[model samples]
Target: MNCEHAKGLLPALLDTALPADETREIETHVAACEHCTRELAALRKAAHLVKELPEIEPPPFFAKKIMAEVRAASVPKLSLLKRILFPLHIKLPLEALAAVLVAVIAIQIYRTVGPESLRPSDMDPPRAPEKAQSREVAAKKVEIEVGPYQSRTPVVSEAERPQARDEQMRAAVDKAGPRRAPVSKDSDKKGFAAPPPAKKAPPAPDELSKTSLVLEKKAKQSDVETPRASAGAGAAGFEGPRYKKPEEEKASKPRELHSDEIGFTESPPPAPARTVEAERPAPRKLEAAPAEPAPPPPAGLARETGADMALDRPWLDESKKAGAEEKAEAEERPRAKSAFSAPAASAPPQVVTVRVDERPRAGEKLLELLPSVGARLTRKQVRFDRDVYFVEIASKNLVALVGKLKELGTVGKASVDTAGDETVIELRVEILGRPQ
Candidate 1:
């Protein structure tokens, strides 16, 4: 029944599309509202004008012509070359088919050949050319020296010279007797081999005078060899520029002597062999020989030794002084205490028995009063008729605590027993309820 609903229905009413009930609603709204009536009238006028308007007729076959034009516009024009080269319907399908055929053929080939056929083991190794093989063989056969000297000379350190001389002598003896069979390289190819010849004998002593004299002579020779070599190089007129600086020449020393250059490879003449006893019994005494007592150390040495012993532990002197001081202080301590301080004679423990009515109330009251007398409850016991409290307090506060107890309850049996050196007294308070 609002203006909006009426306006919507007004158009339907003009077209006779609305039902009677809806039409009645719009009619009633239009009659009640002037604005709705004006709107309904305008709608009716517009509908009537529309009904009177002449119909517009399009060109003959208009839909067919428009569709033809749209089709023509939508399709692109192809050049002769494009049309000839790119016949999509045939070429695209053929290309796709060709690609599919190629993939299928590749897959079939792979499946037929298998991955194992392409493995490295199945292929033959490439062979080197004849000239290269011959060159490699020649290289293996060629003897090339390694190290500072490009000769067969072996480098020997100063320490190894004596051992090498001894070894050469031993090798000479062995060669004179019987030569050992040469070990085959193939026998050691599997890693395990016979022990080396050098390990058979332990090394001989190196302190021989002859060996020392030989070593000294070789050292002098090595020292002289460097200056001689330099002189020779200069005398021969080396045209090459000087590569070594003066500092380097000064800093560098002569190279170590090689075993071959030092003549250690030559064996010395064999000495005459001495007679060897097969076995001699170890010399033993039938009886144990008495041991001789050692002579005492001299007086001066003993005194010096004693002084050193004393100096070694200066703490002994300090400790002795400290101990003497402690002893003196210990001796004077009693005298000082007797003179300046008095001994406190502790009184014996006293027991106080207190009687009261309403024992529980009286026990609680005693517990409250204990702190004032500097006392603590040592023990508490609850009996059927009475409650007992044992308290510990200082001897000086004994009299004060007894007086305070008299105020709490009756002091029935207050007694002090003789004791020795007890600073604190244990008090027994018995609170008894009155008989009903």
Candidate 2:
């Protein structure tokens, strides 16, 4: 037999399914040919290896579990009619029957209590006597007038009421008249009539004087009151009586030219003065004394005077020199102080450092923790010694990353440093031996 023919029969020969003659032929050829022999040996070894594997008996519910999974994966082949006529659950049918029953009950109740059944005509009807009584009561009600401008007596007929209202409106309009009118003396006289003077009884001289004084006081008060009244009228935009000045009143007043009205008295003659004698005084001779010169002021007093003069006028040489020196000294003093004093130094940036000890397989631990920490492995570098591993990871949230790192391994020391707008975190992981 050829190698290919023997190879095809090999599996059947192992299972002992071939005829005796074919099996003998295949075994003989496989033994003789090197290629077929090696193939036969490899097949026998594979079969032996499979047979040697431990048999695992399935659990009691294995078949059921497999069937459930198959059902979940498979799509049910339901017909349209079958799907539409799917069996209703007990609860659904019960709920539908309940709803129908409630609807029937509601309909029965509505019919029993409907408007047709409870209408007044079907229950109780109004009698003719009630209509007549209501009519009489309405007729006896007298209409009462309402509103401020309405008359006390209500007008029953509409035709006469409008005419009366029109008359009243016309009367009110006529009474209002012109808003502004010139004040005339005739109108004033008509508005205010003077009373007739009463006959006075004979009075003593003192009583007459006292009466005159009272009359004068009253006239002054009347003048003052008149101005106040006129001012109020002016403020209200109404024209009032205008009073004349004293001169105008005097000029307007009529006076009688009689001898009794004016009289001039003559001056008395001058008297002559008597002459008196004058006493004479003796004369004395006068002598002229020489004028003495004034002493000069002391040096200190002169210096004080100069200083006062300088203070009074700072433009003077002494004051100007002193002021300029003082200003220059003040300017130089600040410069010297500033030169001696050092500038304040700014505070250093805060740095936090943390150390972790004896963490072997740190790289593996970091890789396991990367997903939990929400960090992406940017770059990874293994040292030439293969003992140290440098891992660069990036995370949007630093605090979460730090927390996750702490949970990952023993945190010997951890530090966070902030510089300007950026936060820098340094982590040093120590491996006991070599990285795996």
The sequence of per-residue lDDT tens digits that candidate 2 reaches over residues 106-209 is: 87765443332132223333322232222112111111111111311111111011122122222334331231111122222332211101012122112334
Write down the TM-score for model 2: 0.19
* Cα lDDT, all candidates: 0.39, 0.32
Model 1 stretches with alpha carbons more than 4 Å out:
1-9, 25-39, 51-54, 59-61, 69-127, 130-436
Which candidate gets the maximum TM-score versus the true structure?
1
Please give the distance, in angstroms, between residue 82's alpha carbon in candidate 2 and its true position after superposition: 26
- What tens digits encode model 1's per-residue C-alpha lDDT throughout 259-292? 1222221221121111000000000000001111
